[model samples]
Target: MTTHFWLNETRPARQAGAPENRVYVRQYGNGRAILLAVHGFGRSGARMERLGLQLGDQFTTLAPDLPYHGKTEWYDDRYTPREFSRILQQLLDRYPDRPVFLMGHSLGGRYLSSCLAGLEHPDLRDLVLVAPDGAGGRYTNWIDTLPSMLVRPLARISERPRSILRLSGWLSKRGIINRYSAEYLKSNLNDRPFRRRIAGTLRSVLKFPPRAEAFERALQRHAMVCTVFVGDRDPLLHHDRLQSIYGPLPSVALHHYSGSHWLPERLLGEYYRNSLLTTVP
Candidate 1:
C-alpha cells in the first residue's frame, strides 16, 4: 500500500487562511526538495499521485487539486492562471529552502508557468511540461483545427449531457484516442470524484478571462531550467506554436516523441523520470 498525506484547503485564499486547494501528497526518496505536480483539464491530482512514488527515491512529491477541481470542490468567481500561480506560491512559501521542481501537463503546464514567474529560490531549479499548453495552434491539422476552433465553441454552448456525448462521439469518430493504451483509457473514467470536478473546471475556462499579461510576465521573467515534451500524434495543440511561446528561453529544450496526448498515462513512470524528472538539477 502507498502512504499518503492529505493537505486541506487552509491556505490564504480562503478567509480563514485555510488551504484553498486540497492536496494529496506522497513522500518518496531522501532528497530535500519536492515535486509539485499538476494535472491537465478533466483530471485530478490523485491521478498523478504515482509521480511521487516513482520519484520518491529522489524527492518528495505533492499532487494537488487545482481550484474548482477534485477534492478542493471550490472555485474562484474570477479565476485565472494568476490565481493558480498565487495559490502555488502560498504553498511554496512554507518550504523555501527545498528546491521545488514544477511539473505540469497540458493546462496544468500553462498554470505552472505562472507559479514560476519572478520567483527566486536557491533550490528551485527545474520546470518541465508534457504537452504543456500555452502556445496557440498546437494542434494544427484540419481535423483538429476545425474542432478546436469551431466545435469546441459550440460544445461550450451546448447542454451538458448533450455536449459531453457529442464530444465523445466526435472523439470516437476521429479515432484520436485510438493510440492511447487501453490501461490509460480505462483510468480516465475510474475516479468518480474527478468526473464531477471536470464540470466546474470547464465552465470556469469558458467564462474566465485569459490573463495573457500574467502569462507573458511569467514567461519573460522565467529563471529556471525548462524542458518541454510533446507527442507527435497529440491533436488540439501544435509543436510550432508551443515553441513559439516557450522556445525563446535559452535554458529550455523541446523534445518530441511518437505518442499521443495521453502519453503521460501510457508511459507514466518513464515520463516521470525522463521528461519531467530529468530537468531537475
Candidate 2:
C-alpha cells in the first residue's frame, strides 16, 4: 500500500517530494491587464493565439496546454487544482496588482472551472466564455458511462478511436447521444494527434464532474464579472441552456449570437490566419 501527502503553508514543515510540471505557455499581446486563456479539448495553447490578437494588445494572454495537449507534460494521474494554480501562479506572482481576466472556449471552460474549484483569487476581474461546455445542457458525452473495471481499458481504446467511432455513431443514430457528441467524435477520431490528446486527458477529465455551482461560487467570491457567449444554433451548448445555468447569477451575463458549435474557430481562426499572412515578409 502507498500513501501520499501534500504540504501547504499552514501545515507543519516537513520534507516532501513535489512533482514538477512542465507547462508550455504561448504568450501573446503586451497589454496592461492579464488575460489567461484556455483552449478546448484536443487543442494546444496555440488554439487561443487568435483570440489574444482579437482582443488587441491590452492584455498579456497566457495560453497554456493542459495534459495530453501541446508541449505540456503531466505524469500524475490526477490534474489537481493546486497544479492548475501553480501553473498560472507565475503570472500572478509577477504582477501582483494587475487585474486578471480568464477566457475559455468549449471544453476549456469545464477544465478551467474544475481547476479553479480549489483556488481563491480576488484578482480575477472577469471571465469570458465562448460556447462553454459542462454547463448542464446538451454537452454530454456518451462514452462516459462504464464499469469501474473497464475504465482503464476504455481510456486505452480512446487512443486509437477508429475502432469505437462506429459505436459512437450507432449510439447517436439511436438518439442515445446528442448530435454534437457524434459529430465531435467522428471529426477528431481520425486524426492520431487528436486521438492522443483524447487518450491522455480522458481519464483525468472524466473525473471532473459537473461544477456549475462551484463556478458560480468562485465568481461571487471573487466579485468577478462573467460574460457568456453562446451560439444560437450550436448543437452542443445552445443559448437557452446556457441561460439556465448563468441566468440567475448576478455576476453573469449571457449573450447569444448567430452561429454553430464551431463559432470560435470560424471567426478567430480566419482573423488570426489573415493577421499572420499579412505580417509575413
Candidate 3:
C-alpha cells in the first residue's frame, strides 16, 4: 500500500489560519479502472486494504482516510457528511480519465451517498455499499444521540488519564461496552487532541444526520449500477429499511448475507470479483 496526500483548496474553511486541507490516500494496484473505497467511522483506510488488494488486479483501488481519521488532517469545525463527500468528490476529480467505482462501508457509505447525490460524474460507473449506516437514519438510537450530547463535556474528562482509565474499566466490567470498543475508547481518551476532534465530529453528525430523500435522489439521478450488501444480523442497519430505501430505484440492487455488521472476507472477495468482472466495460 502506498500513501499519498493531496491538498484540497475547495473545502470550506472553518477557522482562520487553518492549514490547507490535506487528504491522505492509500493506493492499491495500477489498473485503469479506479475503485475509491471509503472506510467506516473509527476505522482507517488500512481496514479496506484487503478489499483493495483482492480487486487490484482489475482496478486501481484507492482508499482514503477521511478527515480526522487516520493521517488526514482535520480542518472543519465539525466533520459533516457533506464535507466528507466533498472531499471524496475532489479526490475522484484527480482521476478524470479512469472509470471510477465507489465503495464505502458504514459511515463512509453515508458520505459516499451524500457526495454522489449532488455530483454528475461521467467516469463513475458503479457503487458498492457494505452494511452502510445512515440508510435507516443517523440518529435512530440513543447510542448516537447520548454521546453526541456529552461529547464536549466528555472531552474535558477524556483529557484526564485517570478519569478515562477508571471509566473505561467500569464500563468494561459491567459489559456496558465490549472489550475492543473499550480499548479503542481508552486509546482515544488518552489522546486529548484526537478526542477533541472526535467529539466535534460526533456533534456534527448528530446535528446533521443523513437524509434518506437525498440518498434516493442521488440514486435516481446518477442512474449508475449500484450493488448494496447488508448483513442480515447487522446491528447498525436493518435489511428491511435498506430495501425500502433502495428498492424503488431500478439502478440499485440489494443483497443480504447471513452474518453480522462485518462481512466475511470470503464473501466480500466474491462480491468484489463479481462487481469488477460484470461492471467494467
Using lDDT, give the best candidate's number: 3
Residue 82 C-alpha lDDT in model 3: 63
Higher-lDDT candidate of 1 and 3 = 3
Candidate order, TM-score descending:
3, 2, 1
Please give, for residues 25-76, the per-residue lDDT of candidate 1 as tens digits.
5444444567777877666677665656656666667777666565554643
Error of 2 at 60 (Å): 0.9
lDDT of the candidates, in the order given:
0.57, 0.65, 0.69
The reply for model 2, stretches above 4 Å from the true place, is 1-20, 76-78, 136-140, 143-152, 183-187, 238-240, 263-281
Q: Give the candidate number with the greatest TM-score.
A: 3
In lDDT terms, how accurate is model 3?
A: 0.69
Clashes of each: 15, 0, 0
Task: At residue 204, give the lDDT of candidate 3.
Answer: 57
Give Cα distance to truth, residue 234, candidate 3, Å.
Answer: 3.1
Per-model C-alpha RMSD: 6.4, 8.6, 4.1
Ten-residue segment with the worst summed lDDT in candidate 2? 1-10
